[model samples]
Target: MRRTLLLLIGVFLASCQSGKDQKEDVKQEPMRTPEARKEVVYQVFTRLFGNTKTANVPWGTAEQNGVGKFSDFNEKALAEIKDLGVTYIWYTGVPHHALIQDYTAYGISNDDPDVVKGRAGSPYAVKDYYNVNPDLADDPAKRLEEFKALIDRTHAAGMKVLIDIVPNHVARNYEGKTNPNGVEDFGAQDRTHMEYHKDNNFYYIPGSAFAVPNWEGGYQPLGGEKNPLSDSRFKEVPAKWTGNGARSVQPGMNDWYETVKVNYGVRPDGTRDFPDLPEGYEYKGYQAHADFWADKELPNSWDKFRDIAEYWLDMGVDGFRFDMAEMVPVEFWSYMNSAIKLKNPDAFLLAEVYNPDLYRAYIRKGKMDYLYDKVELYDSIKHIVKGYGWTDHIPVVQKGLKDIEHHMLHFLENHDEQRIASPDFAGKAELAKPAMVVSATISTSPTMIYFGQEVGEPGKEQAGFGSPTRTSIFDYIGVPHHQRWMNEGAFDGGQLSAEEKSLRDFYKRLLNFTINSPALMGEYQDLHFFNKELNAKYDHRILTYARWSTGEELLVVTNFDEKKSYQLDLKVPQELLRKWKLSPGKYSLEEQLYGSVKSELLVPAGGAGEFRIELQPLESRIFKLLRP
Candidate 1:
């Protein structure tokens, strides 16, 4: 039954990916805008990658504030990624947070004495959106300068640079004040006009930041019929409705304590305290919608966010990578995109929207310029490799990748989910190399490489039997383990292990492939899903696709299958297939050089028989076919 389920998943993933394909199918028609140029983006979680001698300097040491500096580029760490031919650097969450950042008042005891591998919290809990984190950019006056310098460095080293942006909520207590001392919540209407008590704290964002032992989820109301009287039990019901009780943001639906369900049309005190909202929205519908965003005044909220983005742009950030982008209204993104384009035309607006379902609309609506490709990671790479099986599901996932090739963000590791040591990676360095390689430099999408990925570091096995660590976004799963290596090597850290060396080399080669390939940079991404049969045995575990640039064609054939072999049949572009040493099977390309440069694979895989390649377990090959 488990095997069947896995097979089913492989097929589904190969076709319709994380809801993004459904959104794409609906086709929201917007007036055509001129296309943007191609970009080869590489993501780095500054702390987890490598500690530069100047940046962190200690290759093995993991700093609590994470590598400490905007210019903290890890040379040995980056060598592998750069070797894969990096074009842009998406340094994930490098911003700093002030000492006063905490949110224990809202609930989860926001205080953990032990630092995870000498690191502070995640960069998302923004101490001050207006200012760069001191740790990332210490020189307050030269903070923006440092960012520009980093970008210059990236460009000089053959890459562009981007940073993450967490806009939804600010740290509970930044600079000893709950609310940046009057930055204005900005979304809700003037409360004084509505005649509400000042000390009530409802409708006002809290002015405290804590370690939030628990991050709860569920809807909260923004504005509603004003409460007639102050009630202490307000903590017991939906605060958005009856002005009630506590709500938590803990992960998983299993957590009931984290939320106090809100009643949109009905108040908790039951006096019918709801108001009419935007056109076509009922009182109940409005409240439900508010819960989704954890914000009700979305109209104004979005406007404020757009302005905030402008402020950052003015500060000279290349652009932003909006966190949990799907949570934001699609309409709001359209507005933000339009506004942002007017200011920073070439700004790189990448979004942390993990699913494939939302990418098209996010991109089409202008809410985001790029999003992570979960399908490619889960079904394409992880399932085939970790699950260790091959079946009819391979081509299905490959086809999905083909459809959304241009705007997808390809990655094997990031700050979220389990570390490389978890079940996903399964402790096999050899498997990780091919898996990481295919993810980073194959398919014509921007590649996002996490900090420790290059060295194949198996992160700590999450605390609380890994549950608490799993749910804690402030600190990712990989940080703990990485820190051990740092401590063992003593702040200035140890030499790279052999496993680390090989893994690093694999990524470097793949990244360089993209940097050198011009075919990947074309305005449009042309991908072909080979092995088109509905039930080929190797179909589920194998993925095959080719990218076509203006004058270049590259194909990437990767086998996530483990110790399984099956007969394969694939379609070939008559023009290019014939041009290459003619063969019937599909081809693959080096992701790093898709559009920057090109290389033809003599034998992309283990050449054993039938003009085909015998792949040893998890293996990936990049081939350059003659351009049509």
Candidate 2:
């Protein structure tokens, strides 16, 4: 009799704890206003977006492998992108960067091939902050005007424009030829003899001259092409630190030797030369941060970057995609971002910060609108899609980031990541369906897609200075799948294969629903954990969740298994049923993504709600509950 009583009491306590957890799960604050739409960013590599060239010759020049001009993004193209549910078009590699091609006629000096990554050059190595890349314009001298026209066209198509702002470094031969009046170039007023100074733009090694890295692994500039600038020589009187902070005159082959690191008032001893933020500043808004820095003395590099950002804002650019932001100090971001917010309060400040520890600091104190959620969500999804990991880890990851979930941007493909269709990854774009659904709708943060992600660009070309698997940001090569969508500049999917078209249609439906759903901007509760415990058939390959607002309730489920279909009973915790005020009745469950499927949700008196779901391999569904 005593043993029976103890067992019964333990079971009752367990049920009560489970109910309490479910109640707490749905108590999160909404990410934004109920009426606000989620942002979808489309990152297009500007020079390669419209290039229809089939000649993907290794180390090919712009003429051989035809480059896409800014004119390529015509009204038709912009409209098509907008129709894909993109709210922002990130025109990557727009700024004037160091390239091997000769633009001396336009008063632009040729960058040494030894320092340039490819004939096209790395976009991170900004050569002229005030000018646009000459290669992107039909008329080289009118590059900035062409970019401005592109920005205007993007806005006219109902999408904002985003461009790169590489604050951590610049090209080794940076020359601000088109700088605005009263503005001087970086390092112009530097005290070169000193290694570090608050006023100096770059850190120097007092007694050494810059030397080219020793090419190894058979790697050479332009694949050993004989050019005057490729003679293994670059003239710098006093060697400055390499872009990746390599404090050597001769950086290794793997180091970022082509660019020089920009110093932001931090000494070699790790002491800050700038003023620190006041206590309680992290919880404050951008306006308060800006006010705090208004009367303080800042570094010269800080002032220069602020001017560059403000100049672009004046020219109608909506926001920036800061590169390698974590390497730079958060204090610098607080100062710079606050200034940007002061000018354009609605500016989208997305940063490439990979450190999980710095995520909150960058978003809170640094005032960043979004930080790349690469370290957590993207990695977890990649592992699961590749069939090596379980879906159960996702909820744990989300729980860890619950406080700042809305600030972490999600992406499956970016310029730096391998293509989903590449052999190194899932090897098929279809395999990423479930992952994409979860990533876009799992949080209220923004969703970003690379240029050819929808069409499953494998990025297998061996373009010079870049390997297979990932798209080459350094070479002048045409993106094959993206080019098919370009369809001879028709901006239609006239040449896309049937499979590609289907994949693209899937993306369109998913993205459009995300931007239009109020539930996505509302409270979320994890059904995955609940189902895992209550449903006998629920497995680690499946994930389910609930999102709801005033009049909307969504049950999202995904099957990551590419080989198996599931017929399982998915459960909604008792506390969730109570919160929904759903009392012992059958509800209509309609699919929102494809709109061709429906399921039944049955709630029994004194029990959890049940969803009899049939999920196919690599499939995802967003079901809406009809209360009738």
Candidate 3:
């Protein structure tokens, strides 16, 4: 009997120890904030959003090819946009720019066709800072009111409004008819006799008269239309430096000749004429930068842009997208963006800075909220999508910029890039699925999509002044594929084909999941190297990673192959498994993007965990591990 009692006691002790081991193995990870929302910016060229015309005539007049008005973004249209998981709507080309349309009746001077780009002028060449584009208003007299109402409508629809702020330059004819009582137009008080001055807003070529560029390749103002203003002459006594810093009296066709460069107290000899930022200002926040500039004397150009930004902020603009931000000095942005933040602390200041070396300086010292990840991430993905590069290069790019990944916004399509469905790109919108998945979930950065990218806009129309493979920002033209999604103002996919509908549904599902997933906002670990060394079937065309938060763990895998299927056993390193505190057991792997797809994850004792995954061509999966 004593022997039997001792055996029972030994068995009880063994059971207790086993229970303790199991408890320790299944220790829960610390809880984290699950509602960390990722910003999804929808950049809609304001002039192209609502135009349902399919007549894509090159160099067509606004009368021939209908212009989309500000009123076109009605409640229904906004609802459709908001339903796409968009947090911000960047209303591009909202400001008054130099266009060919004559608004002389409204006390606005007509832009010379010799200087303007197309029927609709370049949005980068601003003519007035205080007014909205007259072409966008249903009634030209109430243009500002119409824009304000649009702002209200956008806010009511649960999204903020962003407009462009062209600081580096303005139209060659910088006329601001709607300037406020104390605000003067750019270059109004400039000393034209000298080439450079501390307060001069523009640099002038002394004793040189502006001459029109010799139009080549049969290109003419308005496609050789015989408007009175199309006489190929502009009245300027002293020719200013071209927008591209060209000093010739007449700029070449390739130069940015439609606009003139804005002087920011920088001398021709590269000497800064303005006060420099104090030492250690690079590590400061916007408020400190604002405070530092509050009492300091600044250049006239700096104050001018700050006033223009504040004016728009007062008019309910939530943010500004600075055009060619790298062209302007970083010091100027510190002052301008700080002033913007002072007015509205939550203002989103996105910039177009292409230089990778200048990215950190712009974001840190310039106080910019986000910069385009075009050169690194976007370029790499473009090559991969074109079937030229390897997915192995992506992890390298991410590791290099891991510190600033949140500030580096990722985008598959934007106004500056060719459409994904274009023959020059991937030739099919469906092929971008894996690329989009990687772009949206790979980091904690904002994801941006141009207006018609979801609908497979090929952008093949040879719109005037703009080449094929890119939608025209200069000409008055209709976007064919986007118009089908527009469905004649119903804002529904009434005219979309089955393939198009499926593609759009895929985008909607992925984007919504991105904003809602906590793991995406949490920590990221690259599993590409781990799998490449373990799984024989894994190739350079495949990418794998893991992301986890308190209650969510996600394994993201993407296959960039256009014609191959990958059947491989993806392994998670033992170190990461320990970091996740995943005990040895069976867990359910369920897909989050599309429902009803699942697999199993088997974690054996004292070894790397793995799951058998089969990826079809251009397929991506975000599998969530259902842990016990």
The number of the candidate with the highest lDDT is 2
Candidate 1: TM-score? 0.63
Ranking according to lDDT, highest score first: 2, 3, 1
CA lDDT for candidate 3: 0.86
Per-model TM-score on C-alpha atoms: 0.63, 0.95, 0.94
lDDT of 2 by residue, 1-628 (tens): 1122333323322321111111123222334666877899999999999898989999998988989999999999999999998999999999999998888998999889988998899999999999999999999989988999999999999999999999989999999999999999999999999999999999999989999999998998999889987889899979999887778999887888989999988777666777777756777888899999888888999999999999999999999999988777888899899999999999999998776766767777788999999989999999999999999899999988898888899999999898999999999999999999999999888999999999999999989996889889899998999899999999899999999999999999999999999888877899888888877888999999999877889999999999999998888888998888998989999999998999999999987888898999998989999988
Model 3 alpha-carbon drift over 4 Å, by segment: 1-34
Better of 1 and 2 by TM-score: 2
TM-score of 2: 0.95
Model 2 gets an lDDT of 0.89
> Which 10-residue window in model 1 sums to the lowest lDDT?
236-245
* TM-score for candidate 3, residues paired by index: 0.94
lDDT of 1 by residue, 83-179 (tens): 5566667776655442222333322123221211112454654444555544455454566577666666665565556777654333332222223
Model 3: number of clashes?
A: 0
- Output the lDDT of residue 513, model 2: 97
* Predictions in order: lDDT: 0.45, 0.89, 0.86
